[model samples]
Target: MQTEASPLVDKFQLTEDHDSVFPKGVPWVRYHGKYNDLSINIVCPGKDSSLGVDSVGTVSVSLLTYASVQALHPDIIINAGTAGGFKAKGACIGDVFLVSNVAFHDRRIPIPVFDLYGVGSRQAFYTPNLAKELNLKVGKLSTGDSLDMSPVDEAAILANDASVKDMEGAAVAYVADLLKVPAIFLKAVTDIIDGDKPTAEEFLQNLAAVCLALDQTVTQVVDFIVGKSFSEL
Candidate 1:
């Protein structure tokens, strides 16, 4: 149970009223069991990326991130979800990664002045020591609005040194950066990029199992955060 005085409780006290900001069915949970002092909020923006009301994309994620910051003013923001791993990078289905950095793979600005921003890289908020402590793989993640990735796109992503691809990590990270809030991402591999089957098909096939794995992994992360000293956090 959470007390009214708890920072975590205070942060999310009004989240129930703004359910529209999050994924359609996923609800936000405020945990006070182990880390009552730390304010934490978890959200899952839906899978749709279009401009529709329930869409999921940079725009949607950016809005969610902004609203979350204004509402929570949290010490850290973490985006945990599923992603497609690249086989060429030794990634396999069911593997979980602690993203060290994130960038956009689909954003290709023709103009030279905007190219760097299109391909810009942002570091994860967690320290390398924390990743080692969690025993999770540290890798770069490429993000885009779409789940489907062609072979040519995979090649380009590999060239950029991204080991995993997700639909929302970079957008969340970018917003967190703009707000000067630390952010970290955790992704469980639900499919192999460029595999024999289509990425979407493979993801659907493995979604359930991957989601279970992600649940366990996220529990471990919460435990780690709760056990850490305030200075360490």
Candidate 2:
């Protein structure tokens, strides 16, 4: 998680790091600082305790979001990260997107209304001016825990009409919605899931360049958010 977030943290100069307030052995990391006059905090689900690797996926993100919201009381949340994209959806490696909607692709409940709940569709906060000014592509994002897609996941994602997919976006959206906080999702394309290259190979190859794009785009977004009201966004 820190690897993905490093560029943004560096670009924002978020030097004052705050350790997690959670119980001992929890690995959430928080960095607090200012983006001009705007107060900003960057939270990353730190390494898994036993595994010693980035604690990715929905559970870690959702838990950290809940804790961060309760502690920081942030007015807005930016869930920025890299994601797999679809060439069919006009995505190219290193392209950045502002998510318009988010949903789950792997939670197959199969019941009537529960099926809909399984999908967990949620629209992101409206930001027409921000999108226009940033000149970024806007798309629906589908989230699942798997790094690789299965046929069922593929069908679910297509049904949701998602252009991008990641491990954490929808989870963060769920928390933000529950807390009534506006959120912004900025995703950079790290791999093309529907393309010829293997998913992991492409993702690893493009990660560095994609992170650069993500860093630059997120910086622009924070700059845009400065001095703006929620209604203005």
Candidate 3:
């Protein structure tokens, strides 16, 4: 069994935040050192992806994530936040998901040379044995530069077999892959894609609840990570 000195519990880096997106009563800093670590560091990349999904947002998230990885050099990097789910695929509002794989949905490049980058896939690192202990759903999460998806976009996302949509999962995964660091994502569903309500409306309505659920889920994942045997990590 793991102990206080286990590498898995030695450090952690968290990201994804914005004041408007995560209002008061959200415990953004609740997971730190609850299990014997010195502390758990948190970083807010910038504005929420809802404001815009341009290069500015992506760059901010990537840079902050890269900086946090270098600074903490933690055993694991977790990107925890809220996302929109595809109700067609059973992603209902207020649900939490442990991202299994992530890809970009809005990065279509006609040129063959860049097609691979457009749809790049990255797998999250988590102990399969431990994952079985959590009650969260697991599936592909597609990242894009838009909060709302058009019908055409929804079709493409469904084709990719993505169950959830978010703005920063791919960017975070990409940075972790480049740095050769282990990473995982825990996201709560705040809206249902293609639902009758507008994306923003549903997102705001469920933001508080989603934040709380994410906090609880993140804490569980952390506890599981720290409790793992060294061999398992």
Off by over 4 Å in 3: 1-34, 46-56, 229-233
lDDT of 2 by residue, 150-196 (tens): 99999999999999999999999999999999999999999999999
Clashes of 3: 0
Q: Rate residue 158 of model 1 by lDDT.
A: 76
* Highest-lDDT candidate: 2
Per-candidate TM equals 0.79, 0.97, 0.78
RMSD of each: 6.2, 1.1, 8.2
Please report how far candidate 1 places residue 125 from its true position, in Å. Answer: 1.4
In order, candidate lDDTs are 0.71, 0.92, 0.70
Residues 1-233 of candidate 3 have per-residue lDDT tens digits of 01111222234442323332333542222123334553465555433445532232455677767776775676678788788998877888878888888888887787996977887877888557656788678878888878888776676687668988988888999999999888888878999876889889988788777776777777677777774653474
TM-score of 2: 0.97
List the candidate numbers ranked by TM-score, top first: 2, 1, 3
**lDDT for position 123 in model 2:** 94
